[model samples]
Target: MASRALRAVVAVSTLLAAFTPASAQEAVVNVYTFRQPDLIKPALDAFTTETGIRTEVLFVDKGLEDRIAAEGENSPADVIVTVDIARLSAAKAKGVTQALEDETVNSNIPASYRDPENHWFGLTKRARVFYAYNARVPEKVMSYAALSDPRWKGRLCSRSGQHEHNLALFSAAILHWGEQRTEEWLRGIKANLSAAPSGMERDQVKAIAEGRCDLAIGNADQVGFMQTNARSPEQQEWAKAIHIVFPLFENGATHVNIAGAALARYAPHRDNAVKLIQFLSSPRGQQIMAEQNFEYPVEPRLKASTVVQSFGPLTADALLMDEIENTRQLASEIVGRIGYDNGPER
Candidate 1:
């Protein structure tokens, strides 16, 4: 249907469009991210607006360490942004991340939120919570040990036990209760699953809304996503069906996880990478993440978004990062040994 002249220039137009003049000379920082792209874009865009440094992002759902290692020294990954402390530890262990000892970055974040050797820095904090169908479930607060009660034998729903989120929680449990007790606790949880470990945190929320389960374990941000999901109106219904219950450990503190950033070891654009990270740790950067992603900022002066704050006060346990990272492999092994993924017996 196109004119002959227009048809003749289409391929040429496409070729020319592929190579922008700025691509050849502008400062650019490449990022490998495990967190959703939209979640970090506001802060990255703010960074570019402030410093004129273009950010290039690649999303990898899994195996980021192996991919970065495969690329070796030629990897264009100047920065890595991801969730879960275990993955960050693994990247450093794999020698893909370099220590970042920036004074500006250090001043912006707390020592508890950044690595001791400075390989990664926590950007945002989110709680691991329970979504319970309010109409059917009355009791609000829960102790992790209560998960095994026979009353919940067919009411519990979760993502895979080996998932980084769940694994991190299990690792924390190992440190809190010891491996023998943690394994027994995991076995009890497995015995109560409504379905086989399946889908994402959002899917577990959906299951609760459908009345297929009464209690679902998931991260707090999924509730924010569902409530704000204009693209999927049905998800708003899911959000309305339940109330978030912050599960407590025996010591009365809740489990929290972070989304963090690191510098790649072989970064070609080292200065630009450091600049991006520094910007990401600034008050403006922290604000952007808090407002857009429904997460708690790493900066103590700033508070979580209003929606996040409404989930109830988060009493974070004094979890040691090194201890949690060290115990994660054992957590995965326990999941395997007990066949936690097999779900409850019919």
Candidate 2:
């Protein structure tokens, strides 16, 4: 009986010891992210390594806003991270996110890329640029208007017309060139396709390399990914055949978008979440975002990736991102109306 009592006392003592440190070191941040693990893990590791803050991350591709809204004030999520302006804005409008007053984020991100209401801040920039076969497509055809030329007929390739990147570009054309002109532009480009819409940006580039098409519409980041570490000889050959072109002023420069973050409305670790937001928007964080991820830093002083630099300077479209927030519906209608599903003519 004495031995059994002694054993019980030791178990209690061990449990108390474990609980003490956990209670004392209770500062932890839980982040919900839509970004791919490989792209954002480096920054997450760097933040934890430098700050001694414990972090837990969950990656989900969709329905984050709905989940958080359902959780109401009981949600354990501290920060919500995602790419693209539309997703970020939608989260804010849904009231599952809260505004931040972090000086670092506000001062670092340009007004053009961030929410005017301070609910979210952009971490990186991505521009809609064209990838073309250097041997076939002339670099002078950089503007969206130029794509309408008859010379480009039966010589273009791209992802689904319903994709967000293309939708943003089409909306940019509508903003600058008018609805009639935009629709005409869409029809002209559709006429030029060498194949029915594929589902990926990389495939569009591949089509260009294979001589199935002369030009492809995509973001510049994919070009960098291809040039750096080609998984195969075919990809390397494709890389060799392609050159990037930033569209012109009449398209209103390259329409740049962002990957951004907002505080969860029910953030359990409210203070830690704010700290993380500040950290991500600071110079150190921005530099890591640029150098490691090949994204344009929100901070003005940090240089773009060398691959991005090769494309030369861009004058991004001046239209507000919010203006075309409903482009998904519009794009679906436009693409369907023009019969993009049908492959090019024989």
Candidate 3:
């Protein structure tokens, strides 16, 4: 009787283990993202619901590439998300990311918005637009070349030129106008700063509101933040002071930058990582990105947030992102050469 009772106990234990949820076993994907947690949480929650694969996010504000490289083969990271082509290129250049060859990813993302070798894929696009005080600069149209016009001397504000946001714009300048012309343009812009180019995008708008400068350089999403009371009542007041001007390249299209993601080279959960990337590039994912993040979606079929749509139509620069990536180092060199962040020369 004792032996029969022991056998029954063993059978029940084995059955219970077999029926345990797969999610409870080993279903997880780790993400190392430079993107803010709030911006990506909703999409991640949806992914979990659809796939039963839980996501773990580590929001690394800086040194993401260095950390991933240090982990080497033992890294627990399954994917990396970042803003700007510079960081994505840095990840690839540092050997922390691998190429992805998925049909869903390839089909959903435009070639210009992704790496030629598929190392990274852009999820959203934000134009490098101008934020001009409505009362001071009422002309609705402007060009990148025109920011240097003598009439606006000492009337423009910008963030550090070396920052990824400005570097991407400077890189596009190199691609469109060649290095020499771009350098000249940078010097002209440097000469026009009302105060040392400092502060976040919102700060630039605030500067305009405070009468520090008539014009500022910032992205389209910042405009959405300024216009909507979603962030703060003060920001809405800043929005009231400025109007968005889509600055065009001499060739017609405006320079734009992106927020993107890449699969880790040593991803332990490779399939799950792939699914996450595919999901982010999908139309549904794009919609979530638009609504939650207030950025323009990569998928054309997915409408932008109502606030963004109100900014009016945009014509993105035709230069390939890879082209911009190649010019990033040169752009930094020009920033330093021109003393862009040191404020206008006395």
Candidate 4:
């Protein structure tokens, strides 16, 4: 009878151990991200290896803010990772994220790349660059303002004007050129579209290859991905057909967008989330992110991937990202007001 009782007790204990919460059993951080999993796997894996804290990510292509809001206090999200200042600002505005006050995070990221309130921190940056067909537009250097010239009329392609990428870029334009000029500029770009703004940045590049357009606006990393054969072999041929031109404002600096993160307001593992954020901004984490994603690291000390560097040095515009966030709504409004997505004005 004593032996039987001991056996039963052991079984009960094993069952309890098996049912224990994952966090209690071992460290884990849950991430809700707009970024794709494959793009960030290396960084997450390195974080887990370094800190023994595993990461589980949920990739939401859209409606990330709404989902987090719906989950409320019970949200399993410990961190939020996304691209563009607009999305990060949207998360903060939705009250789904809390301010981070960690010294490590503050030290690793520059003031320009982090929220003044510490709501989010940028991990990497990608310049908003122009890709011109080698056979069509020969000049290696170009300006964003030049894209509006009548000479390039009906020769340009872009993704939807309302895309977060373009919105952020337009926001910067608004800040630099003010509303009236930016509006006029949008109309000019609208006049130049080869087709309706119908696809992503990659499609714009493809458009250039197909002779649908001679020049297109896209992020530098997309160009890097193509140049490095990160996509299909055919894409390498497409990449070969174009030349990357870093477009600058009249002020002589190029617009840039960031891939960034924030701590969830209702993080279940707040401490672990802090650790992850710090690790992401650390030298090792920054290196992993920059190399894997083909983006420039937010840490000035780190170098961008070889493919990105081959494009030449980038002088990022000094405009405050917060200012861009402030103007994003107006930027979207202007895109709509000009019928920028309906293709060339008819």
Candidate 5:
């Protein structure tokens, strides 16, 4: 009887421990993200609910690369997410992230949307579209290269050249047109600025509505957000003033950038981190991203959000996403030399 009691006690204690919250089950993954919180919260919620892996986010408005570089290998970050190829390539080049060996990631993500060396994968592909003042500019000005026609001088508004979004577009031009043609394009676009380079992208759209300029360069998601917002009358006005124009290269493909992720070099939860990466890149998570955030999924064949699809089918730029590693530095030099910040009248 005593022996039976002892066995039962041992079994009960073991069962209780197995069911209890232990360190393993309570593990947290640190994520460093450049995306606005609202954009990624739903996906984050689903990830935690499904896997029981807790998440902690550190949001950076600027200097993310410097922050991550400072942390070095001791960084608590398990994953890093951001938009544009320049920043992602910067992280990979700085050794802040490590190449992953997950077969699921390789299989689920298209080769075009991922690093050739497997260091990062693009989550969504967004076109660098133009936002034109519909009432002021004619539909005939559909091509991006048409912005340089001199007829629109002092009728354009843009974010500063230092902004990553602008830099990525310029980099794409450099890849497609070479330095000389790209320089000429930049010089001509500079000849058309309506105002000095100033303000955020949303502000650029607002400027268009207010008659500060007849056209601007902006991302598609921002336009969707503005048009759909319930409270802001100005957003509706901005939406009304603008129509999107997708630019095509000589080969007839549009330039695209992405929101993407990489595993940190010192990720403590290595296996779980890889699992989460795979999950996000998979068809299921990509769909969730599209539905929740208006982001186009990197997985081919999946329809994007209704708003994304409304922009119509896109033939994205065929350049490797990682080529920013080579293009960014040169782009910076070229942008300054061409005086993008000094305005068109310069």
Candidate 6:
């Protein structure tokens, strides 16, 4: 099983030396994060050791931006870390975040991964991938364009087309295929739904394991989570039932979305906040993130942990995340306009 799982990830490469801590008064940085505290503890610990600055964290699953806004200018939050461009953009739109002007952060992260306006910076990337029932599906590779084929009608499963994951996926479609063709793809997927798109990607995988469908769509990191799931052993069976394939756009690039961070607008410890963010993009911080969460690091030279590399090689798209993000609203509208969640028209 270790050998099998080992092959799932493709080792990305290692990182350079850790960065020198920035100059700052010994102070505390208050954090508001949507990610679990334990997931980021290693990097946070390293930050303290390097900078002599303590970190106080507040963890929440959602509404991070809204909560910061509710706290107003006096909000203690210095940094806000969360997943998805939707949330990151929402924080910027709500004026809960401020533009970060730091050369360390700018140099560590490429322009493609950060907001053009510098409101947020990406720390990691994850792929939207396809899962096939190993015994029933012989194909090892898939293209997103092929999902619309009639051969897959009633044999495919996915979460709602409007979910942020799918919306991001479709938004890429808009970039690669244009609106008319992307609309056609959505309609075709709707026509092919095994049942009305419902539940999460896990549910779609569960259905595949049960033989309700032969193919499913889901995030690659999710499979990593399911494989290592100790609390719910049944998830292991779901992971075992399928092999993941990185789906490519028409231009031959896989789609990836970011998990990034922004500075709180009223950050009381502005200098400390900049240090934490820069450290996060540093080789050491990126290494901690890659190993801890099993995600691809935003740093160009860092590789994913052995466990994550097992998922497969990810050839992320040339399209800037901001480009994909720009089209998400249109993607959502298309999902709504076509009644994507209502299932194939009878």
Candidate number with greatest lDDT: 4
> How much does each candidate deviate from the true structure in C-alpha RMSD?
5.5, 7.0, 8.6, 7.0, 9.5, 11.4
Best of the two (3, 5) by lDDT: 3
Report how far residue 111 has shifted in candidate 5, in Å.
1.7
Candidate 5 lDDT over 108-127, as tens digits, reads 88888888888888888877
What C-alpha lDDT do the candidate models reach, one value each?
0.86, 0.76, 0.87, 0.88, 0.79, 0.85
Q: In model 4, which regions exceed 4 Å deviation?
A: 1-21, 229-231
Which parts of model 6 have CA positions greater than 4 angstroms off?
Answer: 1-26
Candidate 5, TM-score vs. the true structure? Answer: 0.88
Write the residue-wise lDDT of candidate 1 on 62-170 in tens digits.
8998888987876778899988798888899999999998999999988878899999998887788889998888877988888888889889999999898998888
Q: State candidate 1's TM-score.
A: 0.89
**Model 2, which residues run further than 4 Å from truth?**
1-25, 230-233, 326-328, 343-346
RMSD of 4: 7.0
User: What local lDDT score does residue 319 receive in model 5, on the 0 to 100 scale?
Assistant: 81
Residues 134-190 of candidate 3 have per-residue lDDT tens digits of 888997788999988888898999999989889999999999889999999988888
Q: Which residue pairs collide in model 1, if any? A: none
Segments of candidate 1 deviating more than 4 angstroms: 1-26
How far off is model 6, as Cα RMSD?
11.4
Number of clashing residue pairs, candidate 3: 0
Lowest lDDT 10-mer window, candidate 6? 12-21
Score candidate 1 by lDDT.
Answer: 0.86
Question: Which pairs of residues clash in candidate 3, taking residues 3 or more apart in a chain or in different chains?
Answer: none
- Candidate 6 lDDT by residue in tens digits, 1-346: 8986665432311110011113324487878899999988899999999999889888978788888787686577789988888888889999999999889999988898899989999998878899999989888778999999999999989888878889988998898888999999989998998889888978878999999998888888788888888999999999899999888876778888888889999887788999999999888887887677768888757888888788778888867878888999999999999998999887
